[model samples]
Target: MVDEVKETTVHELIASPFVGAYLVLRPGSPRGLKIPRDKYLQLGRKAADDVCPAWLVEATRRCWNLDISGRGVNDAVVVRTESPYGYGRASYGLNLGCNYDREHCYSTSA
Candidate 1:
């Protein structure tokens, strides 16, 4: 059950920001994930604060570098937005970063 939960969470995480954007922007895109430039940095900083597991945060940074580095944007971070089916067209740019110190990273009401 724990493995199942982890798998689900990882899937959601990938689908929420990483691979989700890639699929929308570049269908049949090559393997790997594409996180927004700002998100990439935000996750790195958040990881320093111990917001999430260091491995997860580092993976995002590495993937962002590997995916975005060769795209003519030297030290540039790519930004793309799209609305997936059935989900509200929300902007991830608004998400500052995860605050593990808080109840949740996305609880705006708090």
Candidate 2:
């Protein structure tokens, strides 16, 4: 029998990182984030069970890349996107590498 599925919010979805390293680079992360293992596991299991849509999973995975470093997990990601107001969204993407095109080789905010 399928387990009863609970609806998770975008914030909750945003918070789950430690279920397993199926995609996330960090192990023991979900628990580390203080998310209950059972819940995290349940969520992961649900995702695996196809109750969660594949495109959503893939899209979410593709949307961001977590940066795990010696300093520990850097969940700070910055993405450049336009808001409905036409102003750029302040943040929401993974910061990867440096922009050589720019004069200063600063870390990419996103």
On lDDT, the candidate that comes out on top is 1
TM-score, candidate 1, is 0.20
Instruction: State residue 11's C-alpha deviation in candidate 2, in Å.
Output: 8.7
RMSD of 2: 16.2
TM-score of each: 0.20, 0.19
The sequence of per-residue lDDT tens digits that candidate 1 reaches over residues 21-98 is 432122222345544555545533442224433444455456443233222221222223334543423333434453
| Tens digits of lDDT, candidate 2, 1-110 | 99999984222123333212122222323321233444334444442223433433444455443322211111221112223444322111223443455422354776
Off by over 4 Å in 2: 1-12, 18-33, 47-110
Supply candidate 2's per-residue lDDT for 85: 47
Estimate candidate 2's alpha-carbon lDDT, on a 0 to 1 scale. 0.31
